[model samples]
Target: MTTTSKLIHGYEVVIGFETHTQLATQSKIFSRAPTAFGAEPNTQACAVDLALPGTLPVMNREAVACAIKLGLALGSHIAPVSIFARKNYFYPDLPKGYQISQFEIPVVQGGEVEFFLGDEKKTVRLVRAHLEEDAGKSLHEDFIGQSGIDLNRAGTPLLEIVTEPDMRSSEEAVAYAKELHKIVTWIGICDGNMQEGSFRCDANVSVRKPGQPLGTRREIKNLNSFKFMQQAIDYEIRWQIEQIEDGHAIQQATVLFDPDTGETRAMRTKEDAADYRYFPDPDLPPLHISERWVQEERALMAELPRAMAARFVADYSLPEYDATTLTQSKAMAAYFEAVAKACSQPKLASNWIMGEVSRRLNMAEIGMEQVPVSAAQLAALIARIADGTISNNAAKQVFDALWNGESADVDAVIESKGLKQMNDTGALEKIVDEVIAANADNVAQFRAGKDKAFNALVGQIMKASKGKANPQQVNELLRARLAG
Candidate 1:
């Protein structure tokens, strides 16, 4: 639901997001080690990843390509030259004692992510997106009171996407994050598996009066799921409002959200740029990208969602809403196109896919690709409807049979279920005549201009024929007979 900015105890909620999208590179960003998930601990860590003595970091070209693709996708500016800096920090997982990341200069800058909250269109402005390496994981369980450090994730390529403080509510923040996830996964830049920590969100939340300067913010780190992201931001917003009401000054700090309790607790004081001691990495030279390279990459890129949606509207004459719904996923769009082409009925194909197909998919909690009905099978069923072999109501019965795998073929299902429409004009006319004679009150009322009476007469004809008659044909014949 789209929620407007409402004052909570005379304070407005302000939110910004920082998302880390793990690039789908086969290897680490600066090392030749494998970047596959679920590997045994420490197996993917190499000399460069472990930051051993005399080992130097090498930039992965594939990772750079993925970053470039994202910049182009988001309409961001790809810096001609970018530098990597050492982000000094200390932790059990930080084997190098400092992380190599972009400080002052990032590769992609000034992008916007657009999404819809219910029917409201919202756009979140992006500050910058930079390429960085993921740190190792700290295993706490099954260690007998001693935590073990797993360097497998260390040196993994990541694109840290930072957004401006544009979202006013947790709903808008979650919507923006979901749209970003769709884009990254749609463009093949990231796998976007939240459970595996491929895409992580950090929301910076604060509260203030309408005209007041931005309040002190607390950063909620590492929200992996959209559900948790919303819960965390909601709890943080309430907490800040309560703090201000109680005359407690909100402080800048890093916090972790406990999903089980639906609360955010301060983890530590938030560090600023000065605290990190950001400096240019001496071992790695400045990265450069030529205009020709950008163009070449653009040429090889897939058609984006927006452009594809526009084409669907123009070529297929679909409404903007239907086009957008169909293009939500590439597989769904392709399936719709195939059905439309095979049946030569774009509007009908769109309606069935958006209505019946979508309903089933949502109920089963599966994607369009997992649908049991094939495009050809759906087209064949649509063809039966268009050729007047079956009425729409009958077609639905046939569809159900096909979807449930009761019949392998559309024609076979229709034939076996005896769903063919009663197109015999003589037989349909006799049924309509019989209904007219039987329902004298309805016919008289319909002639007296009661529209419901006419509909009742049509329903009588359908029942008389055991629902085998074409509804349109019955209406036409019944109206003519009554007029005569």
Candidate 2:
């Protein structure tokens, strides 16, 4: 129910998302078929999936458990009893004429996803998350005039998460999607892989004038990547506004995003609930859950991201932003904790991980598990800086060498590079005295209350010391000499 006052081309865009999260299970939803990817066409499907006679669908207990885990993570209501229904549709990809899904009541009901959009907090409400079986993929490649069907993905378990119309901009939609992705993956329910179709998003976009009725929405389907998701929504908003301005009414339909042209094209007319002809499945019975089971599952669940972030704030004395960023992924949080524990400098650990480490990881397009620099090596490097063995810039040089695998040992790199700070008081005093004697005019300017002159003198001292002098010591010594 979140509304925005911002407008684009004198129209406000309304957006909602429907995300399908594939459960991380070894078997299909109702059969014993393996759920591994990249198998040959029609290899993984089984009799139940093919809807052969004398075969009845059996519910996957693990899939239900995964749904429960997601509900607990999102603070949703886990229904005590839910029913399965058959959604009748005609598509070449669907082996069974009807697809089994939840209707009237779903396992998860009414949750909220909260995320930050550049310091402003936003929340998106959930309509429901229902368990359903995925249809097979229709492949059009590798054939001259005919297409092929890959039923390997048929009968795969999917949790369709429907959201209320809350997002107003493309950025907010992306943020909300990312937060949802993080939660699902964090709870060990979904893999959150967009490449393999493990996670998919469909955005319902519309535009209207301020305080006007909601416009007809066209759903952009199968947005596999966040970049494409943002692009598709932005384009759709512009297109809808343009259409309305030209006195053409918006049509409700399903659309596809063409990444090559950066435009969305209509696929087919959108179908309402009645179009599917949903009815309770005669084969499957009502799904029932007890309070004891819910409590047991909750107890076994790992600490959630928000709770972990709060703990980091209270225990490590970290800023809220630092805590939140570190807890974005479980692997990242573990790496930060290891570094902080090894060095006993929580703030320093947070800074290094958020700064240089994040930059390198993003450039390489890899996860924290693939980081070239280990926690132990980073902790040792931070220790050198903390003990004044090297300045910040010098430490960065040592870090670069270690990261590039030039040297594995921190102390060795520091020694080989000759990055040790100049801590000799007598040597520093001599250089300071020479600079003061040579720059009498600059010294007079400093005495006349010019701060820039003093900074220039400090810079000269640093330059004379071959960039090895302790900057703080130089500042203190220069200030004392000038005052005297």
Candidate 3:
């Protein structure tokens, strides 16, 4: 490996993550407004969310319970009393000059979330995880030359999980974020839909000489995509190393990602916690959850993603790779189980899902939930292969047609297209004879033990069949004929 590829200078790369998980509540945190996505601009806003005069913030009990469940799951201390504070900021989308967030007395503290760095499970320490209300969004469009504001997502309940600066590499940080996202989604608290802005993350990055005081840190803001998060960290690490190499000091500032340019641009100087002017909100009362409420929330917790992934491995007798891929999404796991029950070999189902289904989704730039193919349909196709009704090559054709954006029946389409394999030995014999009679020179070369000449005969038979001949069957018959 090149020095640049392996060396991060004499300094070590350090990362701390702040992940925001949007609660799966039907309404906004502080209002009765519906919390739906892709709605008309500013339509979901209620008086409290819009900051109308005399309006008060009403806390959602469901949101509070969800946060408590996460806290317990992380093995953190759930403070019987946690206060809300105002984080002062200015933006068109933020109707209130300040956002309601947790500062001093957050709900949970000093917990850990464990994820695999490779084969080993490494736990990342958490500083805190707190409940907060999200701010609105500001959209800048190229066509209109005017910025638009969308309040549909504003005031949504958010659980911000902050971690200590324990991650040593970008790879570790990305892994930790992915694991945390799964836990939140699995618990049914947050949906963990990154593209929809339901689950997002920010990284606090810094570099320092071996055992030196921590270098100045920069905040990379609001990255929702995992791949983008990894790339952003990598670029920032390179940028920091280069700056130090050139005697330029690393500035403490907030940065924004330019996805188009594959770079992060300066947003503003990174603010200290003191800069937020954090103070408890007098308008709202402290949250006091009794022991009875805690137990009820505990009962609501479901099987965590890691445990569930392990169970799938043992119960289904699936390979670690297959289990990992299937459990990447909750929806994918459910789909896998349905097919696994229908088919005896869970591994077979896993292979088809990871191979064809995943390939089509990636090619079409869609999600598994949006895929046109279904578990039952895929199982039915697998049955056809086992029953010898279709060859493996023929089955691939049917899978392709099913994903081709048509309501095409798999068997009917295969029949209509004449995609069935030409397994008829009598017809194949006549074509093979005609090819050998026509190519006398090639036949002489084949008899003399030239394998390449023998291949030409198989290609001829396929061409005669318009590429529909069963290749294995053709090859077997031709070898028997050519030997005699």
Question: Which candidate would rank higher by lDDT, 2 or 3?
Answer: 2
lDDT of 3 by residue, 234-320 (tens): 888888888899999999999987778778888998888888888888888998878788998888777666667788899999877
Using TM-score as the measure, which candidate wins? 2
Ranking by TM-score: 2, 1, 3
- Which residue pairs come into collision in candidate 3? 253-270
Q: Which candidate is the best by lDDT?
A: 2
The lowest-lDDT stretch of 10 consecutive residues in candidate 1 is: 1-10
Stretches of candidate 2 off by over 4 Å are 1-5, 444-450
- In model 1, the clashing pairs are none
Candidate 1: C-alpha RMSD to true structure equals: 2.6
Q: Each model's TM-score, in the order given?
A: 0.92, 0.95, 0.75
lDDT of 2 by residue, 21-134 (tens): 999999999999999999988999999988888999999999999999988888799999999999999999998898999989999999888777776768899989999999
Comparing 1 with 3 on TM-score, the higher-scoring candidate is 1
Whole-model lDDT, candidate 2? 0.93
